[model samples]
Target: MSKKKSFPLRLDPELYEILQKWAADDFRSVNSHIEFLLREAAKKAGRLKKSQE
Candidate 1:
């Protein structure tokens, strides 16, 4: 596996609560859930390269 990059994220309290719930429902850690969502979005936008896989 490639090294994962890290960065600080800021979220509104309400949004954080929503994400926490969603993550739990999906059986994913909050950070992993966020990454999954972002990856899906980038794939949809054609911003994620196959080479990066």
Candidate 2:
């Protein structure tokens, strides 16, 4: 397993529900799904590179 960093996040109720549903559909925990979404978003924005981490 990778080293984990804990942080606090805030989300709107509506967006939170949508993410929750998507997580359930994918059979993943909500936190994992959010992490995946963040990774993808970062890839598109070029904030994350192949070896940055």
Each model's TM-score?
0.89, 0.79
Give, for candidate 2, the lowest lDDT window spanning 10 residues: 44-53
What does candidate 2's lDDT look like per residue over 1-53, in tens digits?
Answer: 87989999999999999999999999999899999988999988989978853
**CA shift of 25, model 2, Å:** 1.0
lDDT at 38, model 1 = 92
Give the alpha-carbon lDDT of every model.
0.94, 0.92
Model 1 residue runs over 4 Å out of place are none
Question: Candidate 2: which pairs clash?
Answer: none
Residue 26, model 2: lDDT of 98
> Compared with the true structure, what per-residue lDDT tens digits does model 1 show for residues 1-53?
88999999999999999999999999999999999999999988999999854
Residue 10 in model 1: lDDT: 97
lDDT of predicted model 1? 0.94
